[model samples]
Target chain A: MSKNLVEFNNISKFFGSVIALKDVTMHIKKGQIMCLLGDNGAGKSTLIKTLSGVHKPTRGEIIVEGKKTIFDSPRDALDLGIATVYQDLALVSLMSVTRNFFMGREPMKGFGPFKTFDVEKANNIASERMGQIGIDVRDPSQAVGTMSGGERQCLAISRAIYFGAKVLILDEPTSALGVHQASVVLKYIVKAATSGLGVILITHNVHHAYPVGNSFTILNRGKSMGTFEKKDLSREKLLGMMAGGEELDKLEVELKEIDRTLKN
Target chain B: MSVKSKSIQNKSKDERLRKVSRLKVLLNRPELGALGGSILVFIFFGIVAGDTGMFSAYGTINFLEVSANLGIIAVAAALLMIGGEFDLSVGSMIGFAGICIAIPAIYWGWPLWCSILFAFSMAVLVGYTNGILVVRTGLPSFIVTLAMLFILRGATLALTRLITGRTQVPGLRVLIENDPIAWIFSADAFKGLFSWLGSLGIIALRQDGTPLATGVPASVLWWIGMTIFATWLLMKTRYGNWIFASGGDKLGARNVGVPVGRVKISLFIGTAVAATIYACVQVLDAGSADTMRGFLKELEAIVAAVVGGCLLTGGYGSAIGAAFGALIFGTVSMGIYYTDVDTDWFKVFLGGMMLIAVIFNNYIRRRVTENK
Candidate 1:
């Protein structure tokens, strides 16, 4: 079996008197895309924050490469080869593509106090990597705000891949995109998985996840509903589970009664 | 084989489609609007006051001197604004620092150098306090520094009066008249150049038939050096990227490990130190410190920065742009005197210029960001 890049061992997070996440155990393996499915307020954000080292879990441990580890900051998690691309993409729109590509980890040249950003090196790498991801950025100096929504997503994804991310966590990357842009992002997710990196795709849409997800874990109101393999769960069953089977059935009956009353 | 050739052709076509014109890129620079405005202002003044020696070497020097004084503070203010904060206390800090130097050197009998060092330390402390309060309490820097402005101003008046029973402190230049350090800060380095021009009759002469006071002021050199340093720091250094990111989107920058809070704090310190430097130069040249020495300087610096194309909202600006903004201000303020216009109209001109520059900057930003 492929090695587990990162595994959460029953992690629970609490804020004051509220439980943000409770006993959530999910793991992403190498070369596999794990779809973390949840509706709004399903504790997806809290779980991801724990995973990305934004917040520490109140209980339980995070196991990485078969050993437990504690991350003090997002920098620590990044050093461990874990990269999270939030829905906002953490990009400065006013800045250039090259600038955004190497915002924190800029290449340097010269010595001591004379050291400066290696602009040529940064520009070349940014343009080359973006091209590899099918984004034909004309000038690396162009402000990122000028790019299309899908193209910006591509830039963020390509940036992660270039930085040698072993595990990539995408937090609702497609939630704000259109149907076509979302599909383009899904294609990149498949590409990232094929490149031998572990990917956690957090999303509310099952159709977007079904085509790319190797495994699925559903969360409902701070609790894990179930974890299922692609072979074990059919598309209809996964959708039914996500919508809460009993509630969805009642909802459908009520909708039908309303329709019959309107016809009368 | 046919499909492969077609795909290659399509890829090259896409590349061609994405190629932007060089002019478009140049126009997209943050400083472009400021540069154009400076040129236009220069031309307008040149035409209106050209016959009155506005284009003469003397008049050029006059405006340049005025610009240098404001440019020094404006550049630092521009950087702080770019880093996503404001320092309204810079004007009052100048007065305070001046007193810090003058009181120790003249009254306490401290050496000039020691007094200067003491003033610098005070400046840094005040700057650090401003930064910490803003960062720790999550307060808007505008309000924090606004409070600091009043505090520093009131303290300058109260302390100066307490020490000397007066608002003005004199004898700074006399005390350090022959000191080597004074020469470095306040002396003209290019005396030979102006004297040579005077001899050649290229520049005006004094009534005594000697060359009028004409040499490159040390402050001017400092202004140029600081502008260059700031430009290089913003354009060529890793910290420059952090400044842009911090101002552009603080939370976004923090998520990517940009140390946004530290960057902002350092910027505050930087602005304070720049104000201190300005105060030292001004005091050494004038030979005194007054409680009202640098009134409204903070507003002028901010206006210069805004005219230079720095976004009042932060995250977008350039040091070179601010420098040009100062140049425009100096030319207009002094050029009005040469053109027979009432000096009172200068304030009106300043206001109109700022509004026009802001509107132009907004238009350029929209064009750059919305361009396909």
Candidate 2:
């Protein structure tokens, strides 16, 4: 098994008096695809926000590579090689693909006063990285806006990889994609993990996570229902826990009874 | 085969647009609509002023000179606009900077270079103040720069009265007549470096040690160089990307580690520098800083930028477009003068041109996005 890369220990988050996450603990191993599953308002966003440096946990420590690191800003997380591919991807649609790839950190050619963007290098790297991710974008000079939604997500993923992100946090990357497009993005996610990135896939779809995820953490009402490795949890058991199987079935039966009485 | 080979082909004028990237699409997008309007204007002017010297070298020179001056300011304003801000103070900045040059050169009897440098530095200083106030205070740039406009104009009036004992400072009449340096800056230097550069490798020699072609005006050369530099900076640099990103979405840019504050401040400085350049040349040529000069120069500059294809909403524009827009203005001004048109009616023409350009810009924007 791969060594653990990041671990959240008893982390909790609150908004005023309401609890968002409670006593949640999980560990992501290096080169592993870990899917974090939850329903609406089940703390998926809250957890990812804490992980991506968007919010500070009300309780507990986040240990990365065995070091308990405190991140004050998203930039701090990024500098430590933790790249979060936000849902919207934070891309300037009118900028070129190459320009977006090296938005804030463009390579420079000349030294000192004559320093300028290394345009040739940027164009080459952008093309090569896109190709590496199996995204056959014909030209790096194309504007990012011209690309389709799936292509844009792929570009952002490829960009993070190019920037040497050690751990990639994707925030619902496939939420807006079609079935085939989602598969394509999933393929890239798997490729990223295989290529040595510890990827955290944040999604609500159990089916999307089933094939690629090596470990899963299910959250319900701000509390962890279970954190299980692939071998530890059966597909049926996972589904049952996800829907609170017996209780939800009973509730449905009760609703049916109520409808029958009203009709009578 | 990758499942998505379906390309959206735009059946517009040129078919190759389908293969163009978003940035190029946005950059070249404005050019087409703007060029169309320019052609219409050209045809109209050509018919009305055909027999007159509308195409004469002297007339062309005058138009070009005006274009160069206005183009510098427009280019600077375009940069600021693309970064999602406006500076109403640019007009007053012109007056202020011009006065700075005149005061040192005329009153203190400083050398032309020294006085110009002093004035340029003061312009940059004012720019720094404007930028800091807007960015740090989170105030609307419109209000901040508008306030600056009034303050600078008032200061200029007060300073002129205190120094010259008159509202209007006389043109640098003394320097134009006596100073050869001033002549080099304003009047064309004969048989020298500029003609060579403009000739593009063809040398002109005469019997009297004079060149067959005279050097182009220094201001013209300066304008060309600045345009080239600005273009290179905008399209071919990392900072350029940051500018677009910051202007498009400031929060997103900041989240991604871009220094939004610094870029904005730099933009203000660029605008001020451009204004100072224009003021220096204008004062040198007229020999006195006009108190009421550059009164609406800022608006004209902004209008030129907008007509050239800059989006007032920010995050989209081109340096070349601004230059072209300035050219259109210069041509119209000269064309109006040459034709028997009332010169006072020029404002109406400018307003109409701006309205037309804006509408055309909107049309192109819609057409470009209709597919998505």
Model 2 CA lDDT for position A160: 80
- Candidate 2: regions farther than 4 A off: A10-24, A40-43, A54-59, A219-226, A234-254, A260-264, B1-29, B35-47, B104-115, B137-140, B162-165, B171-215, B366-372
Interface RMSD of each: 1.2, 4.6
lDDT per residue as tens, model 1, B59-127:
787798888888989999999999989999999999999999999998999989889899999999999
- Candidate 2 has which clashing residue pairs, if any? A143-B21, A143-B22, B170-B288, B171-B287, B171-B288, B172-B287, B172-B288, B195-B215
User: How far is B87's C-alpha from truth in model 1 (Å)?
Assistant: 1.5
The residue-level lDDT of candidate 1 at B147 comes to 100
**Every candidate's lDDT:** 0.88, 0.80
Cα RMSD (angstroms) for every candidate in the order listed: 3.7, 5.8
Docking verdict class for candidate 2? acceptable
Give the Å error, residue A38, model 2. 3.4
The two-chain DockQ for each candidate, comma-separated, is 0.72, 0.27
